[model samples]
Target: MKLIFYGEKLSNIRKLNGLSRKELAEQLDITEQAIWQYENDSMLPRIDVLNKLGQLFNVDTKYFFTQEYLIHKVSEEKIAYRAEDRESRKKTKLEITFVNFLDYYINFFEQNLLIPQMPIMDIREKTLKMLQETNEDRNECIKKIAEFVRTELGLENNKDLMYTLEKSGIYIVEKKLGTQIDAYSTVTQDGRLYIVLGTVKKSAVRRNFDLAHELGHLLLHDDVDMDILSSADLKTIETEAHLFASAFLLPEMQFVKDFQSLTRKSNPDYYIELKRKYLVSIAAMEMRAYALGLLTYQENRYFWGQLNKKQYKSFEPLDDEIPPVRPGKVRALLKFVLDKEVMEIEEICKEVHIRPDFLSYLFNLETDFFKPYLTTQKDYFGHTEVIPIGDFRDKTSTR
Candidate 1:
C-alpha cells in the first residue's frame, strides 16, 4: 500500500532521535496509534502539528511533501544487494538508525562535496575454483595481493592501514556501529568507495583487522553481490575475507621472521610484546603462527587453552592503552572544503539537513566548534549588517 505523503521519513527521524511511538506521541499530544497512522501515510498531521513536528525533528515540514526526501531502510537502500544480515533479528534498532545516518552522510557529500580518486586494485577472481577453494588457498591469494598493495603505496607491513586507504582516496567514516556490525564497504553510484567502521569502541587491533577485512571485500569481491549468495557461499566469502585480514596485517614473511626470533614459541606473553609491535591481537598472532606451520595443531590447541586459562580471551594487557583508530579521510575532506572557503559551514549544515551540533557529534568534534559558521549578521541577505545589540533603545528596539 502506498504510504501517505512519504510518512516513513517520520519513522526514520523518530528512530534517529531514539524515540518510540509512545514517547513521541506523548510529546506531540497524540495517541500512539495516531502516530502509527501518521507514519503509515493513512493520515497526516494538521498544519500546526506539522509545524511542531518540524521543530521537533529539526526538518522542514516540506520534507514530507515528496518521496525523494523520505529515507529508505538501510538494508533497502543503494547497497541493497550487499549488506549481509547474519543476526537473527532482520534489522536491529541501532542498525536502522546507523543506516539512516549513513545515507544522509553519503547523499550530502555526493551532492555537494568533491571526492578524490583512490588508487585501489579491482581484483578479478581467477576462476570459480578459486572462490570455491579452501580457506588456506584463499588466504595465500590475499596475502600476495595485500603485500603488493602495501609495496605499491610504499607502506610497511605494520604501517597505518587507515592512513594508507585515506591517502589512496578511499573514504572512511567511524561511528559506534553497535557491537553486531564491525564494518561494511560499498561503492557509490559515482564510483566512490567507502569503508564504514563501527567497532570504534574496540581496541585498535580489532578495528585494524576490520578495516583490512573490508578492504579485502573492496578489492576481491567488487563484482559479487552478497545478497545473491547462498548460506554456504556467504560463509565461504566471510571466511575468505577473514583470511585476507589475517594475512594482510601479519605479512607472512615479516611476521614469520619476527616469530622465529622469540625465545619461547608457546608463551602468549611473548606474543603480547609482538602484539604491541604488530598492532594485532594475541589470538590472531597465535592463529597466524599456526597458519604459517610454526605451531602444530596440538601446540596451537595447548596455546589457546593456556590463553583461556589465563583469562586473556577478551581484555589483554595494553588493550586500553591503544586507542581505537579513526577514519580521518572524510574529516580531512570536510576540513579541506571549510578551510578553502569552498562553502560556508552553515551552508554545509543546511545542505545536510542537520544542525551544527549534530554535525559535531557525528564527526566526533568538540561542541560549538562550528558556532562561528552559524553567526549571520543578515537574515538570508548579503547586504543587511547587524545593528549593535548595545545600541538598542526601549522605544525602537530591534532585538
Candidate 2:
C-alpha cells in the first residue's frame, strides 16, 4: 500500500484502540513526532514499526492494505465530521477532541449493552403521551424520576447520582470545551449511552438542563444516527430534548399551581420564584409557561424579546451560589484504593492513571497519604509487636 493510505489506516486503528499518539510512541519506544508523521501521511513507518503498530492497535497487519480499511480510515479521522467547524474560532482542538472522545466512549459502552429496541421517534411519542395523560404535579414527577434513578442505581445523594451515571458509562468532565458547547451526550459503538458536561458552566440550572437533554437523547433517540444529531437535523432533536427537560423538571399541573400561589404579578419575580423552587433557568420556566397556555404566543414572544434586550435580571438569585468542586474520577479512584488500604501511595498513583505530582495537585498532603497505612513491626518491652494501621480507625490518636 502507499505510504499515505497506510498512515491513514494507522490513525483509524489508533483511535479504535483509544491510544493517543504519545501513548503509542511510549509503548513502541518511538518519539511522538514520529507517530504524528505516520498519522499525517507525511512518512511511512518501517516494516518492523508497522508490525508493532498492528499488534498495538489490535488490527491484523494485512488489514491496513485493504481499500475498505483505507476508506474507513479517511472517514474516521476527517476533521470535517467534528462537531465544531473551522469558522468556530472560539473552539479549541482540545474541546473538539474531548467531544469526539466522548462520542466514541458512549458508542463503545452502548455496543456492550442491549439498548432499547424501540425507535427513538416512537419512544418520544410514547413518552409525550405518558406526560399528557399523567396530569401529575411537577414535583411528584421529579421525585418519581429521582426515585427511579435511585432504585435502579442505589444512589444515596446527588454526588452518588453523578457517580452512578459515570459508572454506568456516562462521561461528565469539568472543563470548558467551548462557549458554544455547554454539554453534549452520545451513544457508544456498543449501544451504551453517555453525557459530558463542561464544568465551566457554573449554573446549576444549566447543568440540570444539560443532564436532562442528555437523558432525553438516551430515552428518545437511541437508534437515531449520530451524524443526523450533529447536522441541521439536530435542531428538531434539540427541541424535543428541551421539551423533555422542561416537562421532566416541571410538570404542567404543578407549575400552574406554583405560579398561581406566587404573589408576584410580574413575569420577572414569578420566574425568580419558579427558578428557585425547580432549579431551572428563567428561560425554561417561560417555555413551560408558554407550553401550559399560561402565556399566550404573543406574550411568550414579548417576554423573550425583553429577555434578549436585558431588560430583566432573568431571576438569578444572591443565594444561588456555585458549590465547591469535588474530586474527579481519577482522584476518587485513588481515594478508594487508599481508604481500602489496598496499595502503597506510589503504586496507587500508577494504578489510577496519574503521576505523583498530579496526585499531589488533587490532594495537597505533606507526604503521600498511604504512608501511614502501611503495616509495621514495633518493639515494646523487648517483645516484637505487629502494629497494623487498622487500629488507627478504632481509636482517636493524635499521631
Candidate 2 is scored at a TM of 0.53
Q: Report the lDDT tens digits of candidate 2 across residue range 41-70.
A: 677678888778655543455555543311
Off by over 4 Å in 2: 1-171, 228-232, 264-266, 305-315, 318-334, 341-399
Candidate 1's C-alpha runs over 4 A off are 1-8, 11-32, 47-52, 65-85, 88-116, 121-139, 157-159, 348-353, 361-367, 376-399
Write the residue-wise lDDT of candidate 1 on 62-162 in tens digits: 66665645354344232312235544233445444655575566456545555434456333233233455646666576667766656665557453677
Worst 10 residues of 1 by lDDT: 390-399
Which lDDT value does model 2 have at 76? Answer: 17
Clashes of each: 1, 15
Give all TM-scores, in the order shown.
Answer: 0.77, 0.53
lDDT of each: 0.65, 0.50
